[model samples]
Structure formats: C-alpha cells, structure tokens
Target: MTDQPAPTDVPTIRTLVRLAVPAVIVGVVSALVLFALDWIADIVDKGIWTALPKAIGVDPASGWWIFGVLSITGLAVGLVVWLVPGHGGPDSATTELIEPPLKLAVLPSLALVTVLALAGGVSLGPENPIIAINTALLVALVARLWPAVPSQLIVLITAAGTIGALFGTPVAAALVFTGVVAALKTGGALWDRLFLPLVAAAAGSLTMTLLQHPKFTVPMPAYTTTHPIDILSGLIIGVIATLIGLVAVYVFPLVHRLFHSIGNPVIYITLGGMVLGVLGAIGGPITLFKGLSQMSELIQNRATYSSGQLALILVVKLVALVIAASAGFRGGRIFPSVFIGAAVGVLANALVPSVPMAVAVGCAILGVTLVIARDGWIAIFLGVAVTGSIAVLPLLCLVILPTWLMVSRTPEMRITLPAPAKDPQTPSTPASPSPGA
Candidate 1:
C-alpha cells in the first residue's frame, strides 16, 4: 500500500470542494464510532467498579476489592488477546499515535481490547486504537466509493476526524495535522492541501460536541496575571516533570521485555493487572483509570492533599502508567501522562504556595506530554487546554523549550524488537511484539 497520496499537480478548487462531502462523512462517522465505543466502555466500567461490588457487599474502594478486580480484568483481556481474531491489531507500545491503517478485519478485535482496557481501569487512553479503527474503516469505505481518491488522503482525513472527536476541538486536529502535512514534499498551496482534512476535523469536532461536549479542564483557579516569578516556577515544574517522564521512557523497554519474557498473555497481563491493583489500592481510586476524570478530581481536591501525599500519588500514577503500557494493554499513553503532569503541578503548588495553580499545572503537563508524545504542538495544546486558560499559554510556550531540550535525545516510550528470521525467498524484517506476546 502507498504511504501517502500520489503527488498532486495543483488540483483545482472545485475538486477540493467536491472532496469535502466525503470528508464530512468521514468526520461524522468517526466521531459517532468513538462516542459509541466510549459509551460501551463506561457502562462496563460502572458495572465492574460499582454494581458488582455493591452486589457482593464489598467496598469498591477496599484494597482487596481493587486488587481482585484488576487482576480478573487483566485475565479477561488476556483471554481476548489469546483467542480473538487479529490478536487485537499490533502492539500499542510499538506503534505511533497514527500509523498505517490496519486491515479491516483487525478493527473489531482491536476495538474490543481497547474498550476492555479502558473499562478495566488500565492506565491508558483510546487515542491510538480508536484512530487506527477509524482510519482502517474510513480508508476502506471511501476508497471503494470514490476509487479516484488516493488511499493516503483518506487516511489523513480519517485521522484528522478522529483526533478532532477525541479532543472535542478541530483546533487540536489542525495543530497535529500541520506537522504531518509539512513533512510531505508536494507542490501546492499548503492550505489547499489542508482544506479537506480541516473540513473533516471541523465536522468531527462539532459532532462530538453535540453528542457529549467532552471537557479537558478542571476547576483550577484562573490564571489572570503574568508575573516574573511565575515563569521561573513554570520552568522548574516543567523541567522536573519532563525528567520524571524521561525516566519512565528509558525504563519502558525493559519493562516491556520483562513482560514479553513470560511468553503468555494470560500470565503476564494478569501479573500486570495485579501490580496495578496494588498501586490502585495504595493510591486510592483517584489514581486509577485513564486519568481524565481522575485528574479533575485531583485538581478539585488539591487542598486536601499535602505535598507528600501528592508526590506519592504522582509516583504511583506514573509507575502505573508505565506498567500498563508495557504489559501489552491496548490503549494510549497520553491520558495517563496528563494525569502525571497534573499531579506534578499540584504537588509543586502545595510545596510553594506563591506560584499560580494554573501556571504550574500547564507547565507540568506541557513537560510530561512532550516527553511521552514527543510532539511539541500536542504537548503545548494539552498544557493550555487542561488549565482552561490562555494566560498560561505564554509560560508553557517558554517552558516547553527547555523541557524539549532535555527530552529531545532520550529514547521514546517504544520498543525496537529483533529482526524476524526470513527464508531465502522472503524479505527479512523486524516484527513488533503483540500485547501479551
């Protein structure tokens, strides 16, 4: 399959406008699919964490209950990977946020595992799997319907649509796609190339807003003033969180290798789940899941936690995120990293009361996200978005410079497997390990 759209020689505006119709379909359908998957996951989450516990007369918050549930959830997901078709697509730890479209057949199993991870309180998010599912489905459908359209272009529009839906804003899609489009060597007005993808993004974003209106921000105090000391605080917090994230990044491959050594998804994933349960029990309910709602809770109750308590929560969540990602869980790392960043920010504020809450949070998030995603646009966007403040943007923009410097040369949170043995007639290539191997 082609990696990108066939180079265009300045297509007319009319052609671009014509493509907008399909882009809208791509966007709307992607958003609806994302919403449906998330809805199912939420129901399952409530059932396991609430209904089951209540029926059994066990406190969901108890250490034993938390540990037992997570262990079983891991075993259940392991069975899916072991027995399901497509093996739940590729290993998420070895894949980028947006990769080549998967085979259509892999989408269902991939979606199933993703929903299980989300509901099972796995410390990962829906970004990677959902985007892959949308890309595969849309590319197949759009290519068949409009045989003239390049498959690569369909992939771009589909990814843009899902990202818009995931973040509840077309702007996030735009920011992400800018870097992607800039890398292509083509001869056309940049905006001309971007027009269709933006159309899809806007449609997807609007659809998600109408359906759920997902919000990333918490109830943090407003960031109104721009003080000189605030910049220093932002830089310090950003740098520290970036370092913490880098540690996890370096450790990721080792953890992944350790789990893969078990050679059985059932055993390793269960062990990972048990570890998560222990961490959850120690960190309490606030430290579990993908970290979106949990981050909000942490921020709202920042006053209740001392610096020591916040630090413990931060370490636990960061470690939990690493374990979940390394153990073949079918989810993304961005969500949990945001929670880690928030924890760092709140902890910083607790230690030093003078820094603005929003600044600390934004800068810390900016640092941690940059380290994990290695995407400056996304890291900066998340930092600003999570605080719900524009005033912190300038500080984050500055803080990211130093944080990026520190993390730029570090290895990413991904593994590089050994090359597979090839026959004389077959091309030798390396294959990524699937979750639970």
Candidate 2:
C-alpha cells in the first residue's frame, strides 16, 4: 500500500470552534451560577437581617444589634467549620494560584459562607461565594467538555470572568486577573488568548445586567486641597498605609494560627463571636459584619459618632475580623478591613481638624495599603471604588505607589512560584539501559 500524506499542523476553523465553544459554554454557565449565588445571598441576607432583630427583640435598624448579630454569626460559623469536612469552600484565590481547576462541588464552601454571614452578623456580600462557585463551576464544566484545555488557562478565565462580572467593569477585573495570572506563571502568549474569554465574560456579565438590572457603582469622595498639601499628604499617607499593610500581613498569619490552634474550632469560633459581641456592645453595632451597611451610614452621616467612638469601632472591628477569619468562618476580609480603615480615617479627620481632607484621603490610603499588602490591587480598587470619592484619586494613586514600594522591599512580598520539574533522563543526563537488555 502507498504511504499516506500527513495532515497539515495548521489550526482550522473547526479546531477553533471546538476550542472556543467549550470555553464559551463554560463562561456562560459560570455567569449563571454567579448570578444565582448573588441573588440567593441577597435574599437570604435581607431575610436574616429582618428576622434576627424581631426574634431577639432588638431593632436591626439600631447600631446596638451589631454586636448581637456578629456574636451569633461567629458562633454559627465556628460550628459549621468544625463540623464540615474541608471546613468551608477552599480558599478561592489561594487555590486558583496553587491547585488545578477541579469539580464544582462547593456546597461545603457555600454552606460555610452562608452560615458565617448569618452567624457573624457581618455584611451580607455574595462576592466571595460568587467568585468561588462561579469559577469552580466554569472550570469543572470546561474541563469535562474539553479535557485538552490547559488547567491554568481554565483558572485564569474563570478568575477573570467572575471578577469582571462582580466589579461591573471588565477592565478592573482584567487588571486584577492579569496580575494574579502573571504571578501564577500563566502569562506570555496566554494574555493573547485571554481576549476572547474576556469578551465572553463581559457578555455574560451584560446578560446578568439585562436580567437583573443591576447598577454599576463606584464611590467618589471629594476633598479640598492645594497642590502642595495634597502631594505632601499623599506621600505621608502612603507611607503610613504601607506600614499598616505590613502589620496586616503579619497579623493574618498570626491570627490564623491563634484561632486554628485552640481546641475545638467550633468553640473557638463561638468564643470569637462572643468577643465580637462584647466589642459590639461597647462600640455600638457599627462594629459588626463586613461593614458595608456601616460604610454607607458613615458616608451619609459622618458626624453621627464622636471621634472616640469611631476610634473604638475601628479597633474592635479589626479584632473581630481577625477572630472571625482565623476561627474558620468563611468570608472575604477585604470589606470589613476597608471599613475599619475608613472609620479610622474619619476619626483621624475629626481628631485633627487641620487635616480635614486627611480623613477621606487617609481612609482610602490606609484601606488600599492594607488591601494591596495582603490581597493585592483588587482589594485596593475595591476600597477606593466603593468610597464614592473621586478627589482622592490623585492622592490615592500617590499613596498606593509608596505602599507598593514598601511592600516590595519586604522579603515575604517577593514571592516566586516554584519552577516545574524536568524529566530525569534528559539530553543533559544519560539514561542507563535495563539489566535484561
């Protein structure tokens, strides 16, 4: 028989179709899951917020109940983590970096998050679970449909889409995802490949908007400042923020160890809740949850609390967050942390009348610093974006630069991914023949 000619290696339209189709399906399904999670979380949070107050004979509307809710939340979260295997969902961001994309069986993670939110009396935000479940579902579906797709690419796409949709801005999501992906060694030509996936994700997000009519919002804070003052304050605030960021980095690991080391995670978590409750009792309910509600309240009525009260709330919230996070409760620390920073900034402004602008600017700077130091720019963007303050941008940017610079100087911050292993029997190393041969 005559030898047959080999097929050309060039990619055909059919090949592209096969590849893109799976990704598109994955993207759409992921978006749907994310939307559903967010919807459900919203409904549940509102219900809990309403019912808890009535059940306990405390007005949910009053700041006093913040402690009660947070204590209960912490206790409940502790119980769930102790009882459930794998505690809650896997660490979404960490897993995305270190692990392969796996199946979407994240009920444990979701359950943990829901319970934590309910028990800890923190803010009811779906951003964390939404990202986890969405990415998990997308990666799982894509892997099943196209087994040949690279796992890292799956992680990148899912991260990009989830972040993009949640933020209501693909650009912001892209910046965060690109930074994360670069860290994960999924860069180079992969950036080129991201274009299609990003577009698909943006489309999916748009679809979500059409169905739900969700509004895209960013905080814009106004501050009065001469050029010299703004520049000088920005520099000073940035340095302070950077130092705060380093403290946060050290704080996280220490807190994580402390909470986890105590006997019986459930007990520890409940105790954490109790601690939060006590703090809340002293600081007012403003110290509870993720601080979204409090943030809104603070922005609207900055004068509601005395400077001392704001300072106390800031301290208590920080402690409560560390306790809740370390005790195996599920949720993102970003919102609560930012809220604490803002509270501190407001207090600083009140205490030092000369630097009235410093309150808003300091909050953004400190919040962004802590975020970048611990979780990177997504946290910074979130802190800045939610403030509804635009005049702080130039100052915020200036502050962020020094914070990044300071963090870069730290040995822990200069993390490098471990290189992949090469085969033992390469051209550089001669292989031995089998004894039988």
Candidate 3:
C-alpha cells in the first residue's frame, strides 16, 4: 500500500471540539464584561440626567442643564484621556470596530471614558470600546491559560462574542464574520472555521438575553405588503441617507484636524464637550446621547414633529456625532448613525406621507449604516432590525445595490493622521511619553 500524508493544516474534529470549550468561556466572560460596563454607565446616566437634575429642582430637559451636563462630560472624558493611563486607548477616530488588541493597562481607562461618555449623553455607542476591551482581556487571559492557542483566534472569538452580546443575537455575529472568515487561507469548510465563533457568539448572545433582554426593533406600523413602488421609495431614501453619510465621511478628517490642532487632550476634548453642549441646547434632549432610546422616542412621537423639525433634529444629531467622534470621545458611530438614518426616514414620510414609514426608515438605516460600518451585512442587519420587519428585507436588498456603488470609493468616517513631518533643526523624541508625564 502506498503511504499517504494526513492533512496537517485542517483541524481535526476532536481538536475543534476542544476549542469550543474555551470559546464558550470566552463568550460568557465577554458578555459579563459588557453587562458590567453597561450597568455602570446606566447608573451614572440616571444620576446625571435624572436624579441630580431633580435634586437641584431643575428640569433635566432644560437647555441650560443639558448644556451643563454635556460640557462637564467632555471635561471629565478629556481629563481621563490626558492624565489617565493609556490616554484613553488611542483616538477613536483612528480605530476600526475590530482592530489589534490594546494593552491591558489601556482597557480600564477606555471603559471609564466610555461610561462617562454614555452617561453624559454623548452621541455615540459602546460598541468600539467594549470590543477593544473584551479582545484585550480575553486574548491575554486565554494566552495565559492555553499557551499553545493562537492569539488571533482569541481575538476573533472575543469579537464574535462581543457582537453577539451587543445585538442580543448570534445571527449578527454570523453575518458580520462571514466576510472575516471568507478571507482566511485555510483548507476547511466554511462552517468548520465558523464553528468556534458561532459557539462563542451563541453563548454570548444567550448570556446577554438572560441578564437583560434588549430589543433592537422599534414599535412601528407593520410593513405587511410589498409593492412595486416600495423599491423606488426605498432607493431614494437609501441614496439620500448615503449622501448625507458621505458628507460626514468627507468632513470627518477636517474636523479631527481642527480639534487636534489644539495639541492637548484636556483643551481640545473640553472644547468639544462645550460645543456638544451647545448642540444639545439647540436640538433639545432628543438630540442628545447615544441614539438608541432617543431613536425609539423620535419614531414613537413622529406625529408631534413636522418635516422641518425632523430635518433640524437630523442635522443636529449628525453634527453631534461628527463632533463627538472627532473630539476624543470613546464611543462608536454606529448607534448615532442609526439615529441619523431614522431621522431621515421619518422626515421623508413627513414630507411625502405616501411612503410607508417602515420602508423609509429601513432603507435609510441600511444606507447610513453601510456608509459608517462599510459592511453590507451589518447595514442590512441593522436596517431590518430597526424596523422589525422582514417585509423590508427584499426592498433593502434591492436598495443596497445603488447605495454600495455610491459609497464604495468614498472616504470612510475615520481619520487618517499623517506621519509627523521632521524638522531638520530638531532632534527626534520618543513617540509616546510615560503616563506620569
């Protein structure tokens, strides 16, 4: 009999099964971290926006109070970045949703700043910082426990688990990781590669559900029937939202540069907070904070706002998102982008009244999310999620075609800082100074 070589690269079923054990652990731990951070943020948020205002006998919604809280929030976050270890873990505008893990020392500061931002009504979400935190913590812990396991695998599972926790569904993790796994150069069935991540994601999603149920969908009118005209309506809304997102994408770097020119975290971030306070004062409480609860409020009370009012809210929220991200806030853009998309959709319906609200909102969310995340699956997932209707699925699929083309070559809503120019007369210095400095 001729000798044959067993495939060395492909993992055995037994090997994968063993890995699943750690995947489950990673998932559960990741969810616990997410829950803890969110719990802390919620408590602080209530104190700042609800209890303290009541204690002071001031209306929480009053312009001055809103301005004061947001301005103080900026200052608090700014100090963390300037004096806290790890400088709040790099500029958020320079990072992606999934990047290389940060140092362990950085995670606490990142978490603290994220909590402060969320509590202070920053127009951002917890996605970016939380993912970074989970990835760093899990990668280090898993490496310590299982020295043979690859660090990259830990990063992937942690990310999947975190995503699952954030969305309350493993499906989101699956859709998001499809592109990630497809790019792998290994010899195995796609599902085989996905098995561990799916396990982790499922565990994370279930853990989050058991701890606190979160609903991504809103209570909106049902989208029961699909019509030929719905495609056109969806397309128009999607394209318009995409264009608006593009505007933010193009303007992001300029705003980032303007803020960083001050060259001190406390000064620039504090200035950013004051500006956000001004925006909050102008737009009222609805336009403040990470946009999830505010989005629900906006859609639920659509009847109270005119087209012009909706337009003002949309612009104000978009501007706030830009400023918050640019000015050193530790948060993600996805939540606020979703808010902006809902605003566009509601405003369209207010103007025309013929377009169904679900279609309008879903399509707009699909477009805006696609631009911000640069991932079609997340865009579609969030679009359908927001409207809570599969009826909008086909329409979104159709609308995404044109929206993708529009945004495919556009600048992402991130800042790309240039390498520092050297002065021939000056000696070079260390890139990063000590935390005590």
Instruction: Tell me the whole-model lDDT of each prediction, alpha carbons only.
Output: 0.87, 0.55, 0.88
- Report lDDT (Cα) of residue 122, candidate 3: 91
Q: What TM-score does each of the candidates earn?
A: 0.94, 0.76, 0.93
Q: Which candidate is the best by lDDT?
A: 3
Q: In model 1, which residue pairs have backbone atoms overlapping below 3 Å?
A: none
Off by over 4 Å in 3: 1-8, 417-437
What would the per-residue lDDT of candidate 1 be over residues 1-437, giving only the tens digit for each residue?
Answer: 22223354454667776778988999999999999999999999999999998898989989898888789888877887888898888889998877778999898889988988899888999999999999899888987887777766777888889999999998888888777666654556767767877888999999999999999988888888899999888899999999999989989998999998999998898899999999999998888899999999999999999888999999999999999999888899999999999999999889998988998899999989999999999999999899999988888889988888898888988776675675799774323111000
Report how far residue 286 has shifted in candidate 2, in Å.
2.6
After superposing candidate 1, which stretches have Cα over 4 Å from the reference? 1-5, 418-437
lDDT by residue (tens digit), candidate 2, 1-437: 01211111222335444555555655566567666655665666666677766786867745456656666676666666666554666532232222344444556556556645744465333455555666566666665766666544555556556655655556655655555544434223544434545655675566666666553232334555436666665566556545654665557666666755787866776776776677767666566666766766765577677887777776777676665555555555556656766665666566665664443545454544354334446545654566544555556656666566666656341123455688787555212111000
| Candidate 3 residue-wise lDDT, 234-282, digit = tens | 9999999999998888888899989999999899998999999999998
Residue 333 CA displacement from its true place in model 2, Å: 2.0
Ranking by lDDT: 3, 1, 2
Count of backbone collisions in candidate 3: 0
> Number of clashes in model 1?
0
